[model samples]
Structures are given as structure tokens and as C-alpha cells.
Target: MKKVLLYLKSYWKFALLAALLMGVEVTMDLLQPKLMEKIIDIGIAGMNLDFVLKTCLLMIGITIIGLFGGVGCSIFSTIAAQNIGADLRNDLFAKIQSFSFKNLDELNTGNLITVLTNDINTIQRIIMMGLAMMVRSPLLVIGSFIMAIITIPKLSWIIVLITPIIVAVLLTVNKRVYPLFYKVQQKLDQINTVIQENLAGIRVVKAFVRSNHEKERFRQSNEDYMLANITANQTMAVVMPLMILILNLAIVAVVWFGGIEINQGNLQAGSVIAFINYLMRLLQSLTMLGMVLIDISRATVSANRVENILKIEPTIKADHKQDDTFEIKGQIIFEDVSFSYDEDGEPTLSNLNFTIEAGETVGILGETGSGKSTLIQLIPRLYDVSSGRILIDGRDITEISPKTLRKQIGLVLQEAILFSGTIKENIGFGTGQISDQEMVEAAQIAQAEEFISSFKDSYDSPLSQRGVNLSGGQKQRLSIARTLALKTPILIFDDSTSAVDTKTESLILEALQQKRKDTTNIIIAQRISSIIEADKILVLEDGQITAIGTHQELLTTSKIYQDIYNSQFAKEEKNYA
Candidate 1:
């Protein structure tokens, strides 16, 4: 709550101004009822035209002031709400971007989306209403009650007795509705998760012929969301009718008691009428107060959800301060490194140690879950090691700022992710300017030049989200081109060439040899031929290094390497005929 409140501190002055205008509006409303009593008893009944005219003109002027006050209050409230909302949305997105892979694993994407959009909008609406009616409604309720008591003192006890009963009923109804709203938010998160999963993997879903199953899944989530909302609405629906019923009983008491006083010559007709008007205002404000409390109840749940995200301290922050001017030459060393996704679970990569001198190409071969991807991810500090240390140029990676560290390293994951933009823009995304010559060189190395040039727009052709318009091999090459364009000292490819043919893969490797021979490279591949010619290869089994040698050295000494070599090459030799 405190973290969420800090976002509103900058807009406090505007919020206050809007609340003050709302107070003025409420004050104008209260004064008119009192003036009506005078117009009825003193002007109309007394046969005085001059006094009636003056009072009517005064009422008209006050009404205009009230109208202007309401309009000004709404304008100010909107400004304050929008400013807070923009700041909050930007802050939430920035915080999410700051999260490490581990942090993301703890918080799912669908929940984050729900909080950023729906929950933040909920808080914004509350701010607008809090600035406008939240202040005025309570004031009007209190002022109306006091004026009613003054107008008919003998019947004032009727209001005093009934106010507590109305309040109790409101509290009873609101308590049940308040807790149900949390379930509504949770259900919304589930629905968003299903929708995001379906859209993101639509190809896999349809290819597997699971469309009916997916539809059922979505139907279940949608039905749950609707039911949760229906329950909340049904619970809140009791407050208004319950409030009006209690109010009518109070009104009946006031009218009956006041009639006796009027018959006894203790109260004037004007006083009875004024008291009834004040009672109406009192009931109306009380009704609005009930509705606002319900709004606050729901908004409170959303605020807490939003506040949870704001309060998360990234576990993988760069806590080790170091001199910013130090240069790194990309000499990577892993000493007794171990890592686990769960703190208490078994390590994914355990007690592994290796070194790579600058400009050396190292290949990693391992089966799935053998920690091939996890090994390279540690060098960039995407997830910190559970134990031991990694040093770049003899400096512990903890000491290097993530921005500076990642600036010097380029990574291409197994799944390529491309934004919706021109091919030139994607390759030049982080490298600043890319002359036609630089782009062509990078594309040639990635083996993407032939296909990209085939398009009418060439380098200017636009891509869809995640490069969906491109084929699997084309997407991988474009992804490779993007990384190659960075011109970083250290580049890591984690099974990034699985989709390309052997011939294209060989051509891409040949192009890289000619264009970027000096760049330190680490290639992780499932196929033996992909990494057989590396300067050194590390064979992994169950997170342990079983063998580390050149292809020729491992072909004689390591049985696993021999099996992999034979399995991939024997088939190719047979197909050559």
C-alpha cells in the first residue's frame, strides 16, 4: 500500500484541488434546500413578489456555480487520474523488464499482463471517484442530517435512531462482496493465461488437432471468470435495495411524527417540507456513500495486487559496485560453477569448470536437460550461479554492471524472437547505424542475404510479430544476422541452427569464418557435424563433463563422441549415393 501511495504523491495538489471543488458543489446543493424553505414560507405564502424574485435569482446563480464546480472537479480529477495511471503503467513495465529469468519464472506472463492493465485501470477509476464523490458524498450526508435536525428538532430523534441501522446494513452487505472481488481478479488472470497460450502456440494447437480441447479449456476459464463476476455483482446488488428499504421506514417515521407536531401547532408547513427535503438529501448521499464503499472495496483488492508487483525486489540485481571505466576483453572462466532453478532442488549444472581464451571457438554437445543452455546463460548473468564464480578478464561477473556486460556479449536462443519492423531496423536495432554495406556483410554471414534480397523491399521489408511471416530457417538466419550485427566480442548460439539444411548451415559457418574469425564463439548443437570442426568440444552427460577434446582426439578416446559421430555421418554417407 505504501509503495502504491508513493505513485500518487506527485499528483497530490491536483487531487486536493478537485476534492475542494467537489466540496463546493456539495455546499451549493445544501444551501438550495434551505433557500427553498424561505421561498415557500416567506415569499410565496407571504404574497411578496420582490422577495420571491430576489430569492429565485439567487437560487439560479447558485445553481450555475454548482454546475461549474461539478465540471471543473471532473476535469481536474481526470487529469490527476491520467497522470498517475501513466506513471504507474510505465513503472510497472520497467520493473518487469528489470526482472531476471528467475524472477520471471516465479511470476508468470499472464498474471503480469492482468496486473499491468486491468488492475491499474481499476486503481485509476478509484482515484477519479475518490477525488469527486468520495469527499462530497460524506459531507452532504452529514450536512443534510444536521439541517434536518435544525428544521424539526422534535422529529430529529428519528434520524439519529435510523442512521446506525442503515450503516450496519451497508457494512453487512459490503463485507460479503469485498472478498469475492479478489476471486474475480484471479479468474481474470486465468482467462488471460489461456488466451495468451492459445494465441502464442496456435500453430502447435491446430497441428495437433486439439482445437476442440482448447475451446473447452477456454470455455472453462471464461465460464469461471463470468461466474466469479456474477457472484460479486449479486452480492453487491443487495446494498441499494436494502438501503432504500431502511430509508423508506425512516421516512415513514419522520412523516408520522412531524404530522403530530404540525397538528399541535409546534411546526410550520414550511418546516415540515424543508425537513423532508433534507431527509431526501440525507438518504441520497447515504446511498452514494454505500456505492462508493463498494467501489473502494473492489479497488482495494486491485491496489494490493498492483502493490505486490511494485514491491518485488529483483533477486538478480547488480549489487556489487565497481569502477565503470574498466574494460573487459571476454576471457571467460567458470570455476566450480553450479546452478539450480530451485534453491533446494538438485543442481541443473553441478561442479562444472572450463575456460575459453579470447577469439577461441568452443562447442558444447549434450542431450536435452544436460544443462547445455543453462551453461551459456550464466556467462551473461541471466541467472546467477547457485555456487562458485564466473570471471571475465579476471573480473568477477557480479562486479560488472549487467548493461555493460551484455553490451559486449551477443546471444541467439533456440527460439528466435523478432519484433515487427523492417529487416534493416532489426539487424541495426542495438548497433545504432547500419550502412547498406554493414547490413549486407552481416546478412551474408547469416546467409540471409539471398532470401531478403529476393523480396521487393529487400532490407526495408517489414516483419510480422516474432518473424511469423518467415519460415523456420529464415527466422533463425535473421536472428543470427541480428546478433552478428551487434559485433560483440563474445557470441553464444544455443542450438540456433537446428532448422537450416546442412548445406546452408555449412555456408553460414563458412561465411562467419571469413567475416568474424576473431569473435569468441560458443556453439551449442544437437547434431555432431554442426560442431565437429570446433577448436575444442566439451561432451556433457548428466551435467558432468565426460570428455573435452578436438574431434580427432575424441573420436579415438570417447565412446559417446564416437557414437554421435557415427550416427550423424553414416546416414549422410549413405544418402550421398
Candidate 2:
């Protein structure tokens, strides 16, 4: 709640003005009934035409003024609510952007999307109503009550008796529905997660012929969300009927007693009419007020969810004082670094120590789960070392902020992710000021130029979400091109070229050798042919570096390396026969 309210401070002035205008509107609404009393009891009773016309003109003037006040209230409330929403949305997205990979693991992508879009929109609706209807409803209720008491004291007891029952009803409904609303939101997250997975893996689902299975899966999630929503609505659905019953009963009591008052000369006919008018207005306000409270109940749940995002401190804190202008020459050192996803679980990489000189090409080869990806990720502080330290250019990487360090290192992970954009735009994503020539050069190096030019639009060809229009190998090559365009001193390919064939992979490696030979390159590959020419090859088995030497030296000394070589090239050599 504290964090969520911080956004309101920026628009408090507009909100205050909206509240003031709403007050004026409600005040004018209250005044009209009193003016009706005077026009009926005095002007019409005495048949004073001038007095009636004067009151009529005055009422028209007040109505027009109230209309302007209502319009102004609406305008200011809209501006304030929209600006606050925009700020909240932007701030939330930026916060998510700074979250560590570990943080993302806790908050799934679907839940984060729901909070950013749907939850924030809920807060906006509540804010807009809070500034507009929230102010008007309470004012009208209180003003009507006070005016009814002053106008006809004899009939005001009914209002006093009825108000408490309505308040109790609202409070009861709020309590019963708040927890149910939270469940509804979680159900919504589940529905969104199911949809996201289906769409992202639509091809896999189709190839496996699981459309009917997927439909049933989605149907179950949807039914759960529907059930949760209906349960919450069922609890809250009683509020209006109870309020109306109480309000109508109060009106009945007013009419019953006021008739006797008028018959006994204790109340004027006009006074009874005016009191009834105030009662109806109070009824309308209370009805709206009930809905406002229900919405407020729901909004509070969303507010807490959004606030959790704002309140959670990122696991990774960047060093603000680090010099952004400082350069990295790509000299890397890892001394006894150990890491595990779960702190209590077995280490992914344990007590590993290695050094790569500047402008060196080091190869990392291991079986699955040997932590090849984890090893390269530590250099950029994607995940900090669990035990020891990593150094770049003789400075501790942890001492250097992630932003400053990552800018000099380019990483292409095993997964190929591309946004919906032009081929040139995707390649030039991070490399600012990339001309057509640079785009072409980067594509050539990644060996993606031929297929890109085959399309009629060439670099301008549009891409769909995740570049689904491209084949797996094309996506990987495009990802590589994006990294190469940055021209960073250090590049880590975490099996990024696995989808590309050996011929294209050979061409890409050859291009990298000619174009960026001085760049410190780290290659994580399964095939032995890919890393045979590396200056130093580290053979990893079960998170331990068993051999650190040239490929030739590993073949002679490390049985694991020899076995891998035999499984790959030795079989290939025999197949050629």
C-alpha cells in the first residue's frame, strides 16, 4: 500500500481539484431540493408568479453551474488517473527489467504480464472512480441526511435507523469478497500462463497432434477462472438487494410517518416532497457507493500484488559508482568459482579455476548438465559465483557493475529469441547507428546474408513474434548477427549454432576468424570438430574441469576427451568410408 500510494503524489494537485469540483456538484444537487421546497411551500402557495420565476431561474443557473463542475471534475480525474496509470505501468516495467534471472524464476512471465497490464488497469479504474464517484457519493449521502434532518426533523429518524444496516451490509460484503477476489486474480494468472504456453509452442503442439488435448487443458483452466469469478460475484451479489431493501423500507417509513405529519399540520406538503426527494438521492448515492466499495475491495487486492513487485528488492544490485566509460580488453580469470541454482542443492560448477589471455579463443566442451552455459554466464554476472571470484582485466567483475561489464561482452544463448521487426532492425537491435553496410557485414559474418537477400524485401522483410517465420537455423544465425554487430571484445556462443548445419557453421567460424580474430571468443559446442583449433580447450565432466590443454593434448591425456572425439569425428571418419 505504501509503495502503490507513492504514484499518487505526482498527481495530487489535479486529484484535489477534481475532488473540489465534485463537492461543488454534490452541493448544488443538494441545494436544488431546498429550492424546490421554497418554490412549492411559499411561491406556489401564495401564487406569487415573480417568486416562482425567480426560483426557476435560480435553479437553472445552479444546474448549469453544476454541469460545468461535473464536466471539470470528469476532465481532471481523467487526466490524473491516466497519468498515474502511465507512470505506474512504466515504473513497473522498468523494475521488471532490472530483475535478476533468479527473480524471473520466482515470478513467471504470465503473472508479470497480468500485473503489468490487467492489474494496473484495475487500479486505474478504481482511481478514476475514487476521484469522481467516491467523492460525490459520500458528499451526497451526508448532505442529504443533514438536509433531511433540518428540513423535517419529524421524518429524519428513518434515515438514522437505515444507514447503519447499509453500512454493515457493505462491510460484510467487502470482507467475504476480498479473499475470493485474490483467488480470482490467481486463476486469471493460470489462464494467461496456459494461453502463453499454447501460443509459444503452437507448432510443437500441432506436430504432436495434441490440439484436442490442448483444448481440454485450456478449458479446465478457463473453467477454474470462471468458477472463481462466479464464487466472488455470488458473495457480492447480495449487497445491492440488501441495500435496496433497506433503502426502500426507509422510504416506506418516511411516507408512512410524513403522511400523518402533513395531516396533523406538523409538516408542509412541500416539505414532505422535498424530504422524499432527498431520500431518493440518498438511495442513488448509496447504491453507487456500494459498487465503489466493492471495486475498492477488488482494487486493493490488485494494489497489493503490484506493490509486491515494487517492494521486492532485486537480487542483483548494480554498482552506480563504476565508470561506464571504462573498457574491457577481454582478459578473463575464474578462480575456484562454484554455483548452484538452489543454494542447498549440489553445485552446478564447483571450485573451477582457469585463465584466458586477452585475444584468446577458448573452447568449452562437456556432456549435458556439465554447466557449460553456467560457466560462460558467470563472466557477465548473470549469476554470481557461489564461492570464488571472476576477474576481467585484473578487476573483480562483481566490483564492476553489470551494465558496464556486459556492454563489452556479447552473448548468444542456446535459445534463439527474436522480436517482431525487420531483419535489419533485429540485427541492429543493440548496435546503435548501424548502417546498411554494417548490417550486411554482420550478416555475412554470421552467414545469414544469403537467406535474408532471398526474400523480396531483403533486410526490410518483416518478422513475426519470436521470428517464427524463420527456420531454427535462420533464427540462430540472425541472433549471431545481432551479437556480431555489437563488435564487443568478448563473445560467448553457448551452443548458439547448433541448429545450423556443419557447412554453414564452418563458414561462420571462418568469417569470425578473418573479421574479429582479435576478439576473445568462448565457444561451447558438442561436436569435437568445432573446437579443435581453439588455443586452449577445457574438458569438463560433472562440473569439474578434468583437462585444460590443447585439443591434441586432451586426446592423449584425458580419456573423456578421447571418448567424445571417438563418438563424434571417429564415427564421421568411418561413415565417410
Candidate 3:
């Protein structure tokens, strides 16, 4: 909580102004009971109607003054709290963006989403409410206690006695509620994970006719979340009634003692009335303090969650200080490169040694779990190799700034991800200051131009989220176009054309062969036909490269290659029949 509150340093002036205004409001509140006592004892008791009217006017004016103070405090507190929230959220997002792929894998997407939105919102709310109530409540309690002592010294003991009891209850509640609220946030993360997975794979669920299963899964998650919330609230619910009971009992004791003093003629009626008023104010402040404890407990948990993300140092760091004069010719060399997702786990890619000359079109072939995707992902430095080195153009990739290296390589993953935007914007997504001709040319190269032209709005046609409105094949083409638009010196296609038909896929490969002949292209494909024309092919099995050769050369020499080609060839012949 202390670390998170450091964001408030930038907005201290606004916060200070809010505290000062609260002081002014509290002063006005403290003066009210004293003024009422003066009116009743001097003006009303002496039958001075003129004095009574004047005192009433003064009280009204004081209330107006206090109203301005209260309103100003609220406005300034909001400004400070909102700015703090904005800064904290922006920093948190920036930190997440810096995280390495390994960090992301461990953190998970759903939990990060919850931390960004729900958890930060909790911190923001508590800050806004705390600024107003925390200051006002404490001041009211102390100020009212002092006024009560001044009004009747004999009854001051009641306040001193009641305060310790209220403090004890608040302390106990804080200890119990913190753990419950932490559990509540964990359950919320679970609910969010279920929703995210269900929504993202909604089509798959429907295709498999598992809608009832998804509903049951969601129902179970929602019930756990609800039960967690109920338990926390049930614990918190004990506070208000317990506080009210203490307040009512204290008030009764005051009234009882005051009446006895009145009969003995030791205390005036006006003084007794003022003392009772001050006592209520003092007790009510304690009640508000109890409420503030709940906010503090919940915010503490949120603060810790937010801080956890902020404190994590990204596993991968790029050397921004590296010289900018070096140029990449796209020649890649993997020297004894090996990687494992876990330190003690089996290697995904093991002792891999290979090289691709600049502008060479290379094919990577592997069966399921052969680490095809993992091999290419290492080139972009998405996940650093656990051992050995990967060099691009004779420079270790780690020595180059990630921003500089990634900009020169265009990578399209197996899954085609598109945002909700116009077709033009999707193609020209990150390549800044691109012209219309460039967008058209890239789309043409990816064979997406024909389908794009069919739309009524053409390039201006809007796409749904993840391009769900487009066919699977169309989405793949657009994903290719988006990467092609970068015109990077190196290109990686991780089975990005699997959804497209053979005709379209062949056209896209032919276009790349013709137009992007000068760029290095690494294509990972399941179908042998997809990479049959490549300059060289790599056959991988169990994290080891089994063979490396051209298409006809591999068919003659490599049995694994032969098995794949024969199986795919047989399937093609059967389809042709």
C-alpha cells in the first residue's frame, strides 16, 4: 500500500488543498453545537427575541460557509484521486507490455486483465473515499471530544471510555476482513478466466455441441465467486450493527447521567443539551471510522496485487545502448541453441545447429509436438534460448535492442489475430506513414486483394473483432498481408496459410517467390506440398533436426521426409480421384 501510494506524490498540492478545506468544514461543524447552546441559554432563557433571531441567522451563514468547504474538498479530492489512478494504470500497463513471453506465460492473460481493470478500480475508489472520510472523521471525533469536555467536564469520561471500545472492534474487524477480501479477488480472477476462455472459443464450443457443458462450467465458477463475496460481506456486515448498538447505548448513558445532574441543579439545561449533541457527533465519527476500515482492508489487498506486477523485472532485456549503425542482411545462425519452458523440463528444441543465408526461402517440417512453432519464435527473441546463442547477421540477437530487431522482421503466427478496424488499417497496422499503394501491393502479394475488392466499401470495409466476419482462409490472407505490409528484410510464416485452399496458397507462395525474392522467408508448414518448392527443407523430430535438404534431395535421402511426402501425396491422389 505504501509503494502504491507513491503515485500520489505528483498530486500532493491538490490533496493538500482538499485537507485544508476539510479542516474548514470540520471547524464549522464543531462551532454549531456551541452556538445553539448560546442561543438557548442567553437569548431564549432571557426572553431576548432579537438575540435569538440574530443567532439563528449566524448559524445559517456558518452552514453556507461549511457547504462551500465541503463541496471544494470533494472536487479537489476527486481530481487528485483520478490523476493518481490514471498514472498508476498507465505505469502498470507499460510494465506488462515490457514483460517477456515467459513472464506472460506464468502470469496468464485473465489474471492480468483483472489486475489492470478491477483491482486498479478498487484502489482508485478507496483513495477517493479515504481522502474525504479519513480526514473528516478523525477531525470530527477529536474536535467533538474537546467540545464535550468544555460543555460539561463531568460527562467527559463517557467519551474517553467509549473510544477504546470502538477502537478494539475496528482492529478485530480489520484483521479478519483482509484475508476474506483477498480470497474474493482471487475468485474474481477465476471468474474472469472462465469468461475469457468461453468467449474466445465460443465457436468451438458450439461446433462441438458443448453449450450445456460450458454453461455448467460457468455456473460453477460464478457460484464460487458469489460465495466468496457473500462470506466477505457477511464478515463486514457485523461492523455496522455492532457500531450502532455501541452508539445507542452510549447515548442512553449520557442522557441518563445528564438528567441526574439536571435534577441536582449542577448543570444547566442548555449545557446538558449541547453535551449530548457533541457526544453523538463523537460517536458517529467512530462509526464512520469503522466503515473506513473496510475500505482500507480491501484496498490493501488491491494495492499488493498491483504492486506485484510492478515489481517483476522482465526476464528478457535488450541492450538499447547497442550501436545503431549495424545493418541486418537476414542471415540467421543457431549455434547449439536449446530451449525449455521450464528449467528442469525436457527441451522443446535441443542442441539445434543450422544456418540460412540472406534471402533464402527455407521450410521447417515437423509432426505434432515437434516444436515447429517454438523453433521460429526463437528468431524474434520472443523467448530467449535456455542455452547457446542465436545470431542474426553475425551479431548476437540479445545485443540488439528488441525494438530495432523486431522492426526488421515480420512474423505471422499460426493463429490469425486481427483487431476491429477497416481493412486498410489492418494491413497498414504498425508500419507507420504507409501509402495506399504500399497497402495494396502487400495485400496483392498475400492474395488478399481479390476478396478485399469484392466488398462494397472495398478497403474501407469494417472488420469484426479478430476478423470473425471473414472466412478462415480470408483471415489468414489478411494476417499475411498485415505482416507483408511491413516489408521487413526477414519474414516468418508459422503455418499461417493452413486455412486457405491449395490454389490460393500456391498463388501467395508464388507471389512471395517473385516479389519478395530479396527477403529471407521461413515457412513452417504441415503439408509437404506447402513447402515443396522451397530452396531447402528441415525435418524435425523429437526436438532434433533429422534432415536438411531440398525437396527432391530429401525424398531420396530422408525416410521421415519420405513418409510425410508419401502420406500427403496419397491423400492428394485420393482427392483427385
Output the number of the lDDT-best candidate.
3
Per-residue C-alpha lDDT of model 1 across residues 1-577, encoded as one tens digit per residue: 5677677789888888898888889889988878888888798889898999999999999999999889889999999988988998999999999999999899978888898999889988988987798988899999999898888888888788878887788778777877788788889999999998899999999999999999999999999999999999998878778777877887788778878887888876777788888888887888788879888877888888888898898987755475455566768898999999899998898888888888888899988989999999999899999999999989988888887888888999888889899999988877889888888888999999999999999999999887889999999999999899888889999999999998899898877777888888899998888887888899999888889989999999999999988987898899996
Task: Write model 3 residue lDDT over 1-577, tens digit each, in one string.
Answer: 8888999899999888888898899999999999898898888889899999999999999999999999999999999888988988999999999998889889977888898899888888888888888999999999999999999999889889988998898889878887888888998999999888989899999999999999998899899889989988898889888888887888788889988998998877788778878988887887788778788878988999899999999998666686455667899999999999999999999999999999999999999799999999899889999999999999998888877888888999899999999999899897866799999999999999999999999999999999999998999999999999999999999999999998889999999999998999999998988899988899999899999999999999999899998999999999999
What is the lDDT ranking, best to worst? Answer: 3, 2, 1
**lDDT value for candidate 1?**
0.87
What TM-score do all the candidates reach, one by one? 0.97, 0.96, 0.97
Between prediction 1 and prediction 3, the one with superior lDDT is 3
The lDDT of each candidate is 0.87, 0.89, 0.90
Better of 1 and 2 by TM-score: 1
- Tens-digit lDDT track for model 2 on 427-452? 99987669998999999999999999
lDDT of 2: 0.89
lDDT of 3 at 318: 63
- Residue runs of model 1 more than 4 Å from their true location after superposition: none
- Evaluate residue 407 in candidate 2 and report its C-alpha lDDT on the 0 to 100 scale: 89
Please give the RMSD of candidate 2 to the true structure: 1.8
2 against 3, candidate with superior TM-score: 3
Q: Any runs in candidate 2 off by more than 4 Å, and if so which?
A: none
